[model samples]
Target: MILNFFDQFCIPNLLGVPLIILALFFPLMTWFTTNRLIQNRYSTVQSSFLIYITKQMMLPINITGHKWANTLITLMLMLMLLNTLGLLPYTFTPTTQLSMNMALAMPAWLMTVLTGLRNQPTASLGHLLPEGTPILLIPMLILIETASLLIRPIALGVRLTANLTAGHLLIQLTSTAVLALMNTMTATAMMTLVVLILLSCLEMAVALIQAYVFVLLLTLYLQENI
Candidate 1:
């Protein structure tokens, strides 16, 4: 039963050819492009949403960090698409994979840390130990701070994975229960179906919220560094 539950998370394959690559690419296919004088309503809405999110993320950072607006915006869009797409039946969620999340987190986190070190080494190192730390506690505090710094990417990745996994699991279990009781308990199954619908809606919100939170934290990290 445990293995069966987890099987859904595994990447699907056809004749030894992994189809997960196509799943990862599927979100990008949703976007539409046009060179006409006027854009479609859906495209216009997408552009506006991107602009709004980009402004919110960049507003807190200094001028030096403004250069990263495009990079951060693009990353957010990719995450939003990937997360939303995963909610579709039979779709694989790349962000649900720890490795993929870590891959996204590590480079972005490292870039911020490196930027801080490159621009102000002393200031960056100063972050390792507080100015008012007691002499005796200095070593311990430095070690703790260093560990915390190194753990940022891991935390980022794990937070995303855990949230999505929990939601997916709950949805699956509820769905299975509804299906199992459908024939035996018509009234109960109808109620369960309604609950499943609500849960699915909630999951949709979570999908978008998690993506936004992930990118927002990254922006905060960048803000501290820049």
Candidate 2:
């Protein structure tokens, strides 16, 4: 029954549609925000008062050039919110699953490759192995480059998944222990709760940090392509 409740609601949400929706929403939001900001740069004084006075695009609206990375804000925000939401009681973190992390990594990996290829046809090889590396080491360099490029998204995914998954799992274990021992004995339940709270705070930071790291790496990828 315990598992049944979890499977019905938390599992579906933790594993399914909500994540997809968030994933889509963040990029779209990022695109609109970035585009609005870009247009604002060329706007007239007759635009919104905040635009005139504060020169800020406002919340849920962000600016960082009109590029594809802005669109990738979707991934960042999704990971962030998902990670954060998991910190709440009774919520499962999807990131805890490697499959979910892989989903995130796969896109980034493909984007990196596509970006490199789009930059130049014949020179696509150069991206895999920088311009001036030695011929004797070219194959090795290729492997290294591939690893470095591929690892960005992999690391991003793992960092988020592990951080969130680990935090939540720890909370779950401690909470279960506390409940089981409530009638028997305990002084460490409070300590566990304190640690859980601290981990929750850490999770929030991880969410934001992961988002920033993901975006920054994406921007770097774009910079390389452009």
**Cα lDDT, all candidates:** 0.84, 0.61
Q: Report each candidate's C-alpha RMSD, comma-separated, in the order given.
A: 2.1, 8.4
| Root-mean-square deviation of Cα positions for candidate 1 versus the true structure, in angstroms | 2.1
Q: lDDT tens string, model 2, 25-134?
A: 65469666665655554444425532332222112223433355335555665666666655554445666677887787778767756866766656666678777878
lDDT of 1 by residue, 93-205 (tens): 77889999999999989998999888888988999999999899999999999999999999999999998888888888998899999999989999999999999999889
> Clash totals for all models, in order?
0, 2
Per-candidate TM-score against the hidden true structure: 0.91, 0.62
Over 4 Å off, model 1: 1-3, 14-37
Backbone steric clashes in candidate 1, count: 0
Flag regions of model 2 displaced more than 4 Å.
Answer: 1-65, 122-124, 184-186
Clashing pairs in 1: none
